[model samples]
Target: MKLIIAVVQDKDSNRLSKHLVKKGYRATKLASTGGFLKEGNTTFLIGVKDDEINDVLDIIQENCRSREQTVSPVSVMGGNVDSYVPYPIEVEVGGATVFVLQVEQFHQL
Candidate 1:
């Protein structure tokens, strides 16, 4: 068995989940946040047999797509001000960070 851990963008979670269900795959979704962008994310846990690993991977590849985005850096309103706000900067965003691991055992009640 294999455990597929996929961290996808929040925007794509719903669609991806639906797609997986339609394809007869079960997945558990959890809300997550990205450390780098501090943005909302969705984590999916899928348990699949060895033979089904490729199918799960194909589904992820089709759903989780990466794109470039522009983002701004944080800036201070005034030099004397203690608080600071981020300014809009261009940066790349979107895409999924995925990890697959071998599972020694899996049981469901």
Candidate 2:
């Protein structure tokens, strides 16, 4: 068995989950936040047989898409407030980070 852990953007979570279900794959979603961008994200926990790993990966790849977004820098409180300026910078987002691990045992109760 294999455990597929996928962290995807919040915007793509619903679509991706729907697609996975349509393909007969079961997934559990957990609400999460990104450390870098401090944005909402969804973590998908999918358990499948070894032979089905590729199918799950393909589905994730097709649903999760990366795109660029412009965001302003966050200013810290009480530091350099007198001469602080916020600038919007373009950064890449909306990509899925996936990890596949071998499961020693899996049982549904």
Candidate 3:
């Protein structure tokens, strides 16, 4: 068995969830916060057979796309007042961080 942990941006979470459902994949969703962008995120705990790992990964990759976003570093991530830049910069966001782990045992009740 494999445990897939996918942390995706809020914008892509809904879409990803839908896809998983459509494909008959069950997942446990958790609300999470991102450290870099200080934005909402959703973490999915998906348990699947080893053979399904690639399919789950592909679904996550296809849904969570990385795109450039303009954000003020100081306002969002925070910075020293002395070295604050009062300008918006383009940064890439909207991607998933996934980890697949092997499960030694599985039991559901």
Q: Residue 109: error of model 1 in Å?
A: 1.4
Model 3 lDDT tens row, 32-92: 9966335799889999999999999999988997888898766655546775666788878
Residue pairs that clash (backbone atoms under 3 angstroms), model 1: 69-91, 69-92, 70-90, 70-91, 71-89, 71-90, 71-91, 72-88, 72-89, 74-86
Candidate 2 per-residue lDDT over residues 1-109, each given as its tens digit: 9999999988889999999999899999988897633489899999999999999999988888677777665532236676444676667767888999999999999
lDDT of 1 by residue, 38-81 (tens): 48998899999999988888888787677655544443345655
Candidate 1 wrong stretches, greater than 4 Å: 36-38, 68-93
| Per-prediction TM-score | 0.73, 0.74, 0.74
Candidate numbers, best lDDT first, in rank order: 3, 2, 1
Model 3, residue 54: C-alpha shift (Å): 0.6
Clashing residue pairs, backbone N/CA/C < 3 A, model 2: none
Number of clashing pairs per prediction, in order: 10, 0, 0
